[model samples]
Target chain A: MSTTDNTESLVQLHNAGLREQGRWRVRGISLRVRAGEIVTLIGPNGSGKSTTAKLALGLLTPSEGRAERRPGLRVGYVPQALAIDAAMPMSVDRFMRLSNRLDENTLVEALESTGVANLRHEPVTALSGGQYQRVLIARAIAREPDLLVLDEPVQGVDLPGEAALYQLIADIRRERGCGVLMISHDLHVVMAATDQVVCLNGHVCCHGAPRAVAEDPAYQALYGKLSPALAVYTHHHDHEHLPDGSVRQIDNNASPGCGHDHG
Target chain B: MDDFFVRALLAAGGIALVAAPLGCFIVWRRMAYFGDTLAHSSLLGVALSLAADVPLIPAVFTVSLAVALTLVVLQRREWVSTDALLGLLSHASLAIGLVVFALLERPSAYLAEMLLGDILTVSQRDIVLIFSVALAVAVVLLLAWRPLIAMTVNHDLAEAEGQNPVLAHVLLVVMMAAVIAVAIQIVGVLLITAMLIIPAVTARRFAARPETMVLFAVGFAVLATQVGLWGSLQWDTPSGPSIVVASLAVFLVSLAVSRGRHA
Candidate 1:
């Protein structure tokens, strides 16, 4: 594995081997998350991406390898299945306060940053799916974690909402410089938002610049024809969107207005 | 009120105070039957107490904790589906307790006392034990309130955020068992689950935050307890079943009120 340039790589997964159904399932995967970089993992369903995230967080012990987390390194994560009871009432402020030692101003700022400050007093269950995800992201950022990981963050959200969330994430990452590792099946958004790409098909197929990895023969072979619309995004550039509705350029691969088709 | 009425009321109060938060979490975590399973397992404690000529509270608590630990271990291992495991343990424990009770060389009339509670028979020591357990559970819950909310809302996210989900889950189950053991002598196994479920279920409709829901649950439980005790006094009815009915009534009222507000 290549060494990350940042000295404060807060999280390291060393040859992690995850087991499923009582078998040593996914093996020999390693990851290095720097203190202030966005690294996105893209993989097909059942490719063990979620398992990898769990292992990183110490939610699951590796069957054959180890997960080393820095002492006092805080992490914030959003999982694919949210495991929350919608019927059980909770407000945005209360949810945000679940973090360790968050100040009220920081909470408000996090909410404002996510464009959901108005939801502070509202029952979280009352929020739209998009609003819920945004609030969740806001709650995560309120903790000011050194590493933030999101699993399919935009799944089950509408297109406009997804865009709004992407913008919110970019703002937080730029402002806080927290390391981000997101798992996404949506190649378009993943490509648009992330700096580094890690492709997995039960193993680390490739990890490098998004454009280079997207164009790799191995990546195309694994997730190539999975969806035709996604194939359109494989050749796209990164930079997602800013909170100001501006899109920046990450690479020279695609033109600025190339996402016009999505609109 | 008369001495009998006071004793019954105090017994009801204990159940309400303890079971309200315990029930809410059980409902939230979908561990409703697990609470029932623990309550049912207290019959084994009763049998063991009779067999060994021991006091009921200590015996019940020990057995309930053991059962709770067993449930957590089995659930963690995925040895059986949660519902199936709970059901199997519930019936098995109750059956063993009943069989052992019947085969006792010197059987007493305490079997009915254990099955259908006689609140009038509750000693001062029982009251002390109940209150002590309630206080301990409340203090522990309050201290771990933030992490508990985070863990129950989203285990994976909570785990990533440096809240240990395993410990949180175990603590919660053990607390539920404690509640069950303490309340079993006053409410009985059949109705103990009601005390742990009804108020929380009702509260969800009336409140939109965890703190508010807990308040609503406790408020509803206390109300049910008072009303049920009064109704039992006037109608010469069983306290436990009367309390369950009162809780049901409160739930329906809350549902109607919440619907009316929405409308």
Candidate 2:
């Protein structure tokens, strides 16, 4: 966790324990996200990444531990599925006002910041994946939240859209200085946007800078077989363009079994 | 030409105006079953009203609100699946209401009227009740429109922004309870869920935003009410079923039209 001088620690998960269906699922998970740092949790499927996000947001109380969010800190969250009924006519402008706090100028600034200003009056249901992601980001920002948590914001988007959204998130962090926590499997995107990385596999396997943990032994052991498809920021300097319009850089100098691309 | 048909038409119009917006959220939140749960709880209200000799609508509203709140609270605890909770509460309330109704010795007319609404028997007081409740629901919803939408889109996100998801949810359930109480007197419980779901679902085919969807649902409901009343008068059918069928017909036509547009 990167600590900034100005902002206090917003979230402290002390040895947090969470249970599912009366069974102990996550044990002894401790997390601290200091303000103004973008922390991304990367894990394989069923690794409790989503649960950690929910717990931090106070959506679910830990079964045997504590998730203490600082008093009155606003959180902006974007879930995996955009599951909006497209037929329901809601414009981005109207949706942002739902928090009932932000004034018009702030709302417009948020929309502009997320690059969703031009799409303000358009029906959110008709937005493309990229535009929809942008709208959700704008919705979160309109609240002027102290922490922004996104669960797979770039799940189904094309590479370009995913890249754009990562850039948008980076911009938001820079502009607002809000602490961001993203749960993602996209190593490249998270590495590009986040300052700290927490690798979870039901429990946190490692937590530190993206590059260090990317080469960590635990990650290599778990993702060694699926390295080609899963590795986000493979440090391979041998750059080769693939058929799917993505370049693969296989880093041979670092670890033997750790080579991937940033497509 | 008959007075019965004329009265039923007016009653349907009033419900169409109110049920449209409520139905939109019900559809969006997958609370089609929630309407059923709330409508069934009206039986408890009916039983209590008779047992205590209380004014019917207010008593029904209170009891239904209790049941609705219970469902909301239970859902928050996540003790059981939402569907199971809804099913349990729905049948329990309905069974208890029936048992209470059976135990009380009285003229069966009130019970009959509540079970199968006598739109033709609608008194001036009933019209007044519909008008007043409709006004209250419309105003409250208009005021709380944005927050409600945000809550529906993602309850956790809504709560993160200091908007009380539970309160917003209760506000919706209470509004629904009021709508069901008013409508049960017009459409009856078995047919009431149809009134709430079909119009909104049909409108969803055409509407691109929440406001437009509600407007379309209201228009469809009004049409259904008018045509159903007319058909019942002309063909000697039950007014409630006739209205449902009219709404269903509109829905089918809308589906066809939407398909054609896409084609």
If you superpose only chain B onto the true chain B, what TM-score does each candidate give?
Answer: 0.94, 0.92
| Candidate 2 structure quality by residue, lDDT tens digits, B182-229 | 888777767788888899988876765677888899999889888877
Candidate 2, residue B55: the lDDT equals: 87
Candidate 1's C-alpha runs over 4 A off are: A1-6, A22-24, A157-164, A186-188, A225-233, A236-263, B1-4, B105-109, B252-263
**Segments of candidate 2 deviating more than 4 angstroms:** A1-6, A70-72, A91-131, A141-144, A186-189, A215-263, B1-12, B77-80, B95-112, B226-238, B245-263
Worst 10 residues of 1 chain A by lDDT: A254-263
* Residue range B130-195, candidate 1, lDDT tens digits: 889889998988988878888888877777788877788878877887777777776777788887
Alpha-carbon shift of residue A76 in model 1 (angstroms): 1.7
DockQ of each: 0.66, 0.44
TM-score of predicted structure 2: 0.79
CA lDDT scores, all candidates in order: 0.77, 0.77
Model 1 lDDT tens row, A1-263:
11245357777788899777877667888877776667788888888898888888788899877898889888887777774577668777778877577787999988887788988999777788777887788777888888888888877678887888877776677777888888987555756567667788788877665565665777777766676555655544322322222332343222221121110
